[model samples]
Target: LNHPKLSLCPSLIMTIAFAVRWRDPELVGPARKTPRETKRLSDIEDQAGLRWHVPFVLFYRGRGGDAGADAGDPAAAVRRALGEALVPYYPLAGRLREVEGRKLVVDCTGEGVFVEADADVRLAEVEAAGLTPPFPCMDQLLFDVEGSGGVLNCPLLLVQVTRLRCGGFVFALRLNHTMCDAVGIVQFMSAVGELARGLPAPTVAPAWSRETLDARSPPRPSFPHHEYDPVPPTPFPPPGDMVMRTFTFSPADVAAIKKGLPVQRGGKKATTFEALAALIWRARTAALEIPAGEDARLVVAAGVRGVRDLGLPAGYYGNACACTCRRCPPPGPCGASR
Candidate 1:
């Protein structure tokens, strides 16, 4: 085990020493024969910004003496479950292709990557400080295998299972963002878990009717989308020494902030999200100390699952969200107001 210390913050440094024994990645496909077909992605899914892979990691402690624990190989069991899960969600076990107009399509190949590895570190030791973001030794934990990170002609789903010294394990995956969003991936993982638990099929069946989200033949102009309008170039260059920090707000703190806000029309109170967004925007604007007359914009992405007009089905997994930009007047009035 190689000892390497990673500094998460000024006061926190963690030693992540783990010698990983990586096995050859194998292709896990659908358990049953699925039709080989080509399906075009929705316009939103084929966007330039969404053509990358999203990585996620989940850590599990040892199930010490649990009755439900698998006596067989856990990695093998998970691979088998993934193959079963792909039978219904076969599009994920495919490769992406781009045709004319940069439109992306899925060529159903029934190939998904599954890698197994063993780490010399203990899960308890890794969680000694705190199970938080900016994890130490992230590259080792979620190694991007060769030929698995491309946006086209690559496996849409890549999973790695790393067994730790204490019988615990780390599950990491890279999924193409254009295929599904966070909620969609969670649904797929839930289906895999259900198959692993010996279920006949997923409670919610998989759906891939992306054509429902296609744009109208003749684009109908609805509300003006000002977010897409061109903006003047910024006078200042981008900051190079940027640092990421996570802030935690308790329920009481959020409630207190909401309590200070003025009641809306019809006696409706401000929501927790609204209050926190306002508070954070004000604090950030003040900290940045931008010019008083300059406008500030806060962008938020909202899901369209609740919108009745879209007519999305229960198991439809795709990009179903849009970003809304709110333009603030100026630093002075924005920060000074309630």
Candidate 2:
């Protein structure tokens, strides 16, 4: 481990200590009949395609209460936990391959990439330096991704564990978006963490029942779902440079905002997310000076998990979110005009 102390300046160097293939153990065998094979992507998943991988990094200070556990080789412990976790999430271990030029499917190859790295800076130093508007860089924190064909040819999953100078660590993960959503990411990561802590299995076991999300026979729609309406092909404009800024809202700030929203006659209130989203939407539209005569819409996605009528099991990990479009005139106070 390189222990040269450094600050979190632009010149800080992060080195890859080692890179290795972390495939499933021979004892776990192959991903043959596990519900992970050739599993069809739901409409939501299909729409996402394989254009990007969801990458996330978690920073932990010190040994994180584990004490003497995995004292000498924490990365090895994480790799072992990941290997065991992959047995249940075998699809993540697989590769995505195009089926017939028109569709894509998981190849179920049972392979992944694991990397260990060393950062010369302490976690506190990095935090004090302040991350930028577009999120912090994962350059040394994650394995460098290579471009392959139109869709990335990288492994379905890539993980990097970087040790900090202050005995802290960062666990970074890159997951293909086609196979998992935000919910699935949480589910998979939780499983790995549990196993790393010497637990037998994840608190919530993953289920690969993609068939439940299939389109109905004859595809009858009980109600109009304008959210999925097809738009006429139009000339595409060049993409604009986008900036993402993370905002932290304190409990008091959230409470104040919630208090400003009107309560329904029945005393019902909008959720914190709904209230904040409305405020943001209005602010953006007003700032952009959108025409009042134009129609504006808020596209919201709601998860259908635990809905009694869906008949989905508790462990189902496939796409379960449905989108709804609420349209309004592009003017007035926050477009809440009924």
Candidate 3:
């Protein structure tokens, strides 16, 4: 509605303008505030923002070994998992890419973002001793990588492990929020699991190409520089039964909100995304106690798929998103008809 010539515009503009909306925060995970380091989170942010791509790091807990007080040779188990994972690890295992004199590689060491410890140890003793890593899934070794500026530093996910009662290693794949959304992580992990088990993943990569997915030219930052305001930290690491949190909304509730809205007869139907986004914009403003006419933004994101689609190469890795925002202060309560 903001654009004067959107429909008549090229496919690129239509894709950029006609984003589906949802009340949920499509972009929930925030990058950790940049700690002093050689590599800055901003570099990743800028690179991803331009392309509308995000990164997702997954931690997997392997099957635990025989009864033992200490985790038995985790590095070896990790190596075996790597060997089994094969092609899924290909993107990471391949040679370094020197981009204008920078190296890009993977954590062949297997222990990424975690210190592999014996899961056999009793939790009662571990918790009573009070000497556990900040979390339980300690199988993922580390998250060190070279890019943008040597040593990418962000904890999209820090993996760890625990011994379940059934003796299966509870591999906790810590996910980095700044990289990709939960759904994206799930897709990637399922692919990895399929490969580890020697089965074909249930995915057909999307039709992707830089030419097809990238902006024809540089994208004119549609929304203002900043969209979501800095949210005060919430309960340490979102509470959940598993490693990540997933959500579902009732169809009736969604339809009720959509029914209240009026749209141009010729325009696209109001989607769940639009309804949710409009609701979030108002909620955030009200929660912060800003004036009724204040403005805010809502962002929706999707990852770019290359020729392979879901299994597309990593070069396509970057941000793909659009923001719904209040252009100027409103005279009454915040309204999308802005």
Among all candidates shown, the one with the greatest lDDT: 1
The lDDT per prediction is 0.80, 0.67, 0.36
TM-score of each: 0.88, 0.80, 0.46
lDDT score for residue 216 of model 2? 83
lDDT of 3 by residue, 224-244 (tens): 454455534322433463253
lDDT of predicted model 3? 0.36
Total clashes for model 1: 0
- Residues 10-102 of candidate 2 have per-residue lDDT tens digits of 432232232222222222222234554565556556664335777788888875433234455667778889888888888777777666634
Worst 10 residues of 3 by lDDT: 19-28
Clashing pairs in 1: none
Off by over 4 Å in 1: 1-12, 65-71, 231-240, 332-338
Q: What does candidate 1's lDDT look like per residue over 185-215, in tens digits?
A: 9999999888988999999897887987888
**Poorest lDDT segment (10 consecutive residues) of candidate 2:** 22-31
Worst 10-residue stretch by lDDT in candidate 1? 1-10
